[model samples]
Target: MSGQRDRGGYHRQRPPTPSSSAPNMSAADPSNVPDAASARSAVTDTSELVEARRAKLSAWRSQGIEPYGKRVEGLVGLAEARARFDAEVQAAYDEAVAAAKASSSSESVDDPRDRVRVAGRVMQHRDLGKLVFLSLRDHTGDLQATISKALVPADAFELAKRLDYGDIVVCEGPIGATRRGETCVWADRIELACKSLFPPPEKWHGLVDPEHRSRRRYLDLHVNPDSMRTFTARSRTISRIRRFMEDRGFLEVETPMMQPIAGGAAARPFTTHHNALDLELFMRVAPELYLKRLLVGGMPKVFEINRNFRNEGVDRSHNPEFTALEAYEAFGDSGTMMELTESLVHRLAVASAEDRRGEDRVRTGDEDGPILPFGDLDIDYRRPFDRITYEDLFERGAGFSCREIDRVRARAREIGIDEAKLDDWFVVNEVFEHDAEPCIDPARPTFVVDWPSAISPLTRAHADRPEIADRWDIFIGGMEVGPAYTELNDPDVQLERFEAQLRDGGDDEERTFRSLDRDFIDALRVGMPPAGGLGLGIDRLVMLLTDRASIRDVILFPLLRPASEAGVE
Candidate 1:
């Protein structure tokens, strides 16, 4: 189709046809449509239906009504308005009306059902001559508004009939059940709020294309209730976590995202230079070091729930930018952190069960309690999570004890790793990760404790087993949810660990961001109490609880490549 450029620079193809442009317009079957990669070409700026909607905007202006409405007052939520429908009141009014009709009386009883003013985007519209039936939707839910020609003014009826899909409108009326018993608003007045400029996705197959859904998330949230529900649950989950921490006497604090030294965890960092200061900065991979400094400053209990950035690959559980929960408790050990982690997670699981059950009592333990579904598995979150020593798990899964250096190295080499150049502990870890990790039952929440000190640079060494660190990593559904550690407080040992890490300069990329945080060492010298630290991946937890398979599904507006960058047509 030929096109003409609009004032905003978008081209108008042609005026949309009435037959082709009703609410819930039936488009070509999605099965017949091209795959998502090629489907990007099907939608463009210049389109007939788009131009038609723009014409409605012009027509609205000509009629002395602004298509983009001003602030409306006294508007109630659609859900709240629907709830105002009193069954007893409606029955009384209906009975009185029937009595008047049967007696042929001229008198009438005043309609007393609750009256409300509400606004929403028009999702469905059926114009049958003089009457209009519309389905309006707001964030709360959908409500039907019925406008009869005899009940409303001539101009208001005309406005209701002319309304299109996606248009925002305000309705004022009494809430009552219709003849069909569907709770609806019998409209006495209707006014335009905003006119939509583009048609919504077809109703039957709303926003089915994955690429399209990500690119146009606004549409995705509106058209797909599942996406809406997932995000809603995510918000509540974060809120619940904050409340849980606060009730336990944890002070929430914020730390610098751009740090001079990214001395948290050993992960690749995204680097940038500050133009004003002429100094380089790295996006923090973890909040570990800064939080430790707070501990030195004598903050007894502190926590931070915020975003962390890392130069990492994207997958079902990985995101370059993600939310995390880091908490530190002074005078507490790794055992303390383990208890805290278990209590927090179990409470959350119970809350998830309560949310799913509504008013019903949530069962616990085995099949009776709240068993939240994670993918194909129903994770049992009852108290006393399964626990096993790292060494024992490694031996069981690798068919040899982790202390057997020769066997561990041989097994690493058998798995095609260059074991001769790697350290004994590194080889053991490699084998453990490759074999032992998979042995944990995905259906149970398990804690793998007592890692080797060589691999746990920040954990305090066990009293009896100096070679092993006092640390534990929690796993659920084959994914590591979080890790807890009895933080090392000795300034000398901490400094020695830092120096050792520096000497063992990893590859070029690792060495670039790896540096000694002298300030943290100084803080340790100032004396930090024996403490326990915990870091939980908030995004991954949300994914599991929400039953979302991909991290991208739980995160609203997850990073995506631009169409041009993706090479999509």
Candidate 2:
């Protein structure tokens, strides 16, 4: 027989039967046990498994035990408990037990191993008549728990014998190694923490369908450890961002989600009606206007990490509602924001690389910086990212400058773009996106600055070159991560720009939501300081850092079609 260790001591032989005073509970009835045939069938049939679990639930109640137990205090995480295991103490205890057994003495040897209380969902269970082994899983990782019939009370032993795969339980015992050298918690006390009525997914093959994973995120998070780690990393990344901003004197603030005018960006907004004021409001597409309002209120530096809603098409890189980081710095230009963004992204990439390698492999001044894989490409986020003017890239790709309207029109038509209906600058941008953007090295982060003034309505034009706006966009991993702009704070220019956007031709749907924000113009009239503004897609950033191929994987609960529409039961 295998030796067992207890809090009081270690014993080579079977300990004395547990006393009757252990608990006022009856033994499990033999008649309640399922036959071999039925037990095998239950594994393949979820309904049968659920019925079998319900029978065990009733049996637990008959024994004067609550399957849904009360709160258990002093419980440590399974990972922490596993880390506290001491090999030297276990070896010493084993030596003493062997010494006592050789002399044929009945005295117990003092055990020196650490004891821990842990709670987790049972992922695997094996009943060996006298000993039961269970693999329990929590967010951190999985750990094994061994239950000895001779160590725990009769009722607790019986409960351990009948534990289902998904049942949550709390186990308390000393940490020790098995005779086979497997580290486990030799549980002396076990109690059911929660009775899982529904049958879980198959133990070996969990939920594999992508749609199902997103629809039932709880099960996805439970069965898939990678999903859990991705979200956990995302949370840590956001926290690090907050600390970084705070350290740089950027005050975090919250702004209105619903606004009378969605004037921040040129995107369709979700509309809602307020009964109290009988007013129509649009969900904010971006918090740029509000964050700028803070600057007008005398806040030197302000940032907001929050949700923005836009009524738009959904794709791998776009979601109707998404998280974004918007920051504004007073008395700064696009150059200032460019440096800040470069530093922030580089640091995040370095941290992510360290996490992947399980060590601090890269540092700020390291000659070979961190390189993370995104799909098939390895993105190198070294400092001083590649930079080029927008017109220069356009000329490189299209073989003509953006100022040459006839050539831009010719290239737009060659690319099947409707150049006749669109204006000259619009055609130029369309051609640029099609022919020029792809010319960039997808593996290297690059910033394209000096955008045309017509495309960036809310951006300040260059002092010498009024036709070019002082705006820049950073692209990485073939995706435009974000943009920074020298904000237009002059009230007259701001109002004129807003009117021009409204005058630009659009469908009726766009016309309905497009309206001027006189209040924002008034805020600019309050003598707001010239500032630089930035907008970053948090979901895309997480996707890049985590090496996730889709934006939905980063978002915990991405929008999905209804079950009826999606043909899912």
Best candidate (score: lDDT): 2
TM-score of each: 0.89, 0.89
- Show pairs that collide, candidate 2: none
Q: What lDDT tens digits, residue by residue, belong to model 2 across residues 26-101?
A: 2243343443333443343445566788999999999888999998899889889899889899999999999999
Which residue pairs collide in model 1, if any? 363-369, 363-370, 364-369
Tens-digit lDDT string for candidate 1 (429-526):
99999989999988889999999999999999999989999999999988999999999999999999999988894787788778899999999999
RMSD of each: 7.7, 11.6
lDDT of 2 at 489: 92
The positional error of residue 286 in candidate 2, measured at the CA in angstroms, is 0.9
CA lDDT, every model vs. true structure: 0.85, 0.86
Q: Where does candidate 1 stray beyond 4 Å?
A: 1-44, 358-367, 565-569
Task: Write down the worst ten-residue block by lDDT for model 2.
Answer: 1-10
